[model samples]
Target: MTNPCDCDIRLIRIDEVIEITGLSRAAVYRMIQKGEFPRQVRLSVRSSAWVLQEVREWAFSRVSPTGLVD
Candidate 1:
C-alpha cells in the first residue's frame, strides 16, 4: 500500500511560478499587489509558495478563446 502522505499537494516556489506563467519577477509581484493573482501561503518567515492548481487556474482564466481576440 502507498503512504497516504504521498498524496499531499506540492508547493511551488516563485521561480517555478515564473516559469509556469512566463512572467517576469516584477510582473508577477505587480499582479499580486493588484489582487489579480493568487496569494502565496507562508511556509515560514523566510519562505512562501502558491498552490499549484490555483496558479494553473489563474493562468487558464486569462486565456482568450479562439476568434475572440480584439
Candidate 2:
C-alpha cells in the first residue's frame, strides 16, 4: 500500500469541497451523477469524501486558457 504522507492523499469532506470548487452541494452531486466530477470515497456507512487532489484537478480542468470556467 502507498503511504498517505508520501502521496498527500488527503480526503476532503463536502463542505470543504464546496468551498474549494465554488460549487453548490447540489451541483456537485449532479455533476457526479453525470460523471463530470470525481466521485467520493466511502469512508463508512454514513460518511464519504473526495480526494483533495482529484477535486483540485477537476476544478482546474474547468478553467479555460482565458482564465475563465468554460
Candidate 3:
C-alpha cells in the first residue's frame, strides 16, 4: 500500500512535455540522447511518458539564482 499524499506522481506525454519545457520534439529527444534530460518511462511497446515531477524539476534546475538562464 502507498499513501497518496506521500507522492504526487504523474505521467505526461510528449506534447505536454514540449508545452512545459518550451522545447521542440526533436530537442527533447536530442537532450535525452545526450543525457541532458530526464528519460521517459516505458509505458508499453508503443507508448511512453515522462515523470511530471522530474520534468518540472529539470526545468527548475535550469534557472540560475538571478532568475534567468545562465
Instruction: Give me the candidate number with maximum TM-score.
Output: 3
In model 3, what lDDT does residue 4 have? 69
- Backbone clash count for every predicted candidate, in the order shown: 0, 0, 0
Estimate the overall C-alpha local distance difference test score of candidate 2. Answer: 0.95
lDDT of 1 at 20: 93
Ten contiguous residues with the weakest lDDT in model 1: 61-70
Query: Candidate 2 at 58: error in angstroms?
Result: 0.5
TM-score, per-candidate, Cα-based: 0.79, 0.89, 0.91
Candidate 3, number of clashes:
0
C-alpha positional error of residue 47 in candidate 1 after TM-score superposition, expressed in Å = 0.4
TM-score of 3: 0.91
Report the lDDT tens digits of candidate 1 across residue range 1-70.
Answer: 7758677577899999999999998998899999999889999999999989889988887777763423
Q: After superposition, how far is residue 15 of candidate 1 from its true place, in Å?
A: 0.7
RMSD of 2: 2.0
Pitting candidate 1 against candidate 2, the one with the higher TM-score is 2
Across residues 28-56, which tens digit of lDDT does each residue of candidate 3 receive? 99999999999999999999999999999
* Candidate 1 pairs with clashing backbones: none
lDDT of 2 at 23: 90
